[model samples]
Target: MVRAGFLLSIFLSMALVPASARASDPDPWFGHDKFLHFSVSNGLAAGGYAVSSLFWEGRTERLIAGGSFSLALGAAKELYDMTGRGDPSWRDFTWDVIGTATGLALAWGIDELFFRSDARKPVEAAATPGGLAIRW
Candidate 1:
């Protein structure tokens, strides 16, 4: 719960930056490029979570891995843009963060809803007439 509140606060602050501060910015928040950033970040985050699940057993570790992977890629993109290939926009990064959070939340919720029970159930083995049967 504390983590959720903290994340919410960060998101709100990023989203609510004053209009006056962005008055001279060329990039619009609702631009098509922003959409791409959001979508790519979302996909990357979910993919990272799925990949990390193969290595990590804990939910928190998986979430961190996924979120960090997405954010690192976003930052790398921004850094590349800073090298004169394209315009670097904080708005794009903000969208990336939002998308990452959304993707992580959806993936985590799906995991909890669909996979939690299976993980929690204990495995049992019983001896049959011919062999041993294993069940979870």
Candidate 2:
């Protein structure tokens, strides 16, 4: 379904990283720059979700908005790097994707736990002559 397609697209995008970028990346996966990319992307994704929530009622829509916003910025940064301003590294983009997913999941969890208006209402219980009756 839609989930399968989404996952496939993610994997395909990762696979599409240019060979030149991969070959020229002298950066370590655990470098400080990678940490920065991860943290910043995480924050951006969460913030995007938070902002999108004000206008969208659907969880899927919010998630898409947040993820797309974060990933677009990550792609933009890599494209900028490719323009000779900095070293372009697909590893950085990979960290960005990981961070974006983490942030979106965290935000979705928080929204479900605390902000969901469609959550079930509290059950009511009444004592009957023979037993307790509950109404949802």
Candidate 3:
């Protein structure tokens, strides 16, 4: 039940982000914000995976699924941007992948760092307290 709800929420939220954006088309990009975006997205992806795989027990599989989903979703988003309502920026897609990876790393690092005193320390861990023994 919990896992279903989280999956539904994340997928739906992604769909909702640009219902109309998909109708149009996006242009390309010039500047770059790779590390920052990748890091944030990585953290977010990890957290998102934790939530979606609440019923699962294995950590490796959950991470792989999460990573696969993130990559596919990022590519899909880029495709949508090109065909539908976003810009045709392959660069952005690349960054999206990078970000997702970074976000996952950050989430893990945070968990390892501050998962003791306050569960809220790790952004990703905070998002999904499934395996965490967070006091709060």
Candidate 4:
């Protein structure tokens, strides 16, 4: 009987503790965090796009890969923040998405404006007796 009563009291206390610990005030630095999230996501997206462009021939493929990487990184950070120290905010995620899009657009614009003409044209591959040969 004593053990049962003790366990019941412990459960009641655990439930009530969280209710009292809830804060009534808003965070002071909420706006700054959104900007930080945007800048970090933007830089990450631009870097991902730049590196992927070096390996991918198709523009659509490179954009998709870069965007996916950037969004995944943001999601990972948000999930990590949810553990204890920080709460996940959808507003910050919205900024991250916007920043990633901006970064991708910038990368595409730079590539199209400056590097398009510098690329070597691809040559058609010819099928030979033993294998296919490609000329650039």
Candidate 5:
């Protein structure tokens, strides 16, 4: 399915990291790479959760699937970097995890705010002459 292909693409991208740096002295962007990683990974995680929710039922399942995808992707990227000219920083991975948490919160908030299922609505009960009647 599309999810499988998407995951494969992510893994392929990680595998494509160059062994050597093509440019001299990559910019860290005012030493804010950690922040960038945090925010970007957070967004990626949220997006993954949102997408997974479309295919998976139940909040817990969606959260687990999306979170696992995000974490695996982040770890894979870091591991790939370690093999290249780029040094793998645990600090970056920490930020990625924080970002994933933020993303889950965001996804949950959005689901609660806009995508709540009506199936959870309470059923109504009416007293009848013989017994109680339930209405959904």
Candidate 6:
């Protein structure tokens, strides 16, 4: 996740700011490119971190795993935009990671709120779906 975030950050903050999306716009953020950049970066980072936390600690290995996933997701998103009518840019990748990182924080906060007492499990685990059960 960290690696992905880093790559996305670079793509958005540097790669696309002055190049791509010159005549394009993002849906959620509208014409605000900065918003897109941060959103993507945090989203990808957080998502990767969340997935890794499912099977590993938030250590180096876990972080790396998350980063790798983030990178792949970022690539996929770019590819999606490329094939679609949307404008694809490196900056978009940056925003994805920012969004991912934000998601990670959100996930951690949720775990703390719903499963602070439960170790090595998701916050909501009725075994229904979203996360781990609280009672096991």
Top TM-score model: 2
**Tens-digit lDDT string for candidate 5 (1-136):** 9999999999988777774545665545335888887888898888888899889878888788768888898999899999986778887888889889999889988987887877778878787778868677
Better of 4 and 5 by TM-score: 5
lDDT of 1 by residue, 1-136 (tens): 9999999999988888875466664788998999999999998998899899999989899999999999999999999999999899899999999999999998999899888945588878786678867676
Writing each residue's lDDT as its tens digit, candidate 4 over 1-136 gives 9999999999999999999999974533357887888888888888888899889977778788778989999998888879986878777788889889988888788877777743555766786778867677
Q: What is the lDDT for 69 in model 2?
A: 96
Backbone clashes counted, model 6: 31
lDDT comparing candidate 6 with the true structure: 0.66
Report the C-alpha lDDT of model 3 over 1-136, residue by residue, as the tens digit: 9999999999999988887567533333435444544554676688766665565555456567667767777777667878869565667777778777766666556645654334335543244456655433
Off by over 4 Å in 6: 1-34, 97-136
Each model's lDDT? 0.91, 0.92, 0.64, 0.82, 0.83, 0.66
**RMSD in Å for candidate 2, one decimal?**
14.8
What TM-score does candidate 6 get on C-alpha atoms?
0.43
Stretches of candidate 2 exceeding 4 Å from the true structure: 1-25, 122-134
Error of 3 at 88 (Å): 1.6
CA lDDT, candidate 6, residue 8: 88
Q: Model 4: which ten-residue window has the lowest total lDDT?
A: 24-33
Model 5 / residue 96 / CA error / Å: 0.3
Q: What TM-score, to 2 decimals, does candidate 2 have?
A: 0.71
Worst 10 residues of 3 by lDDT: 24-33
Query: Which portions of model 3 show Cα errors greater than 4 Å?
Result: 1-40, 111-136
User: Which is the winner by lDDT between candidate 1 and candidate 4?
Assistant: 1
lDDT minimum window of 10 residues, candidate 2: 17-26
Off by over 4 Å in 4: 1-30, 117-136
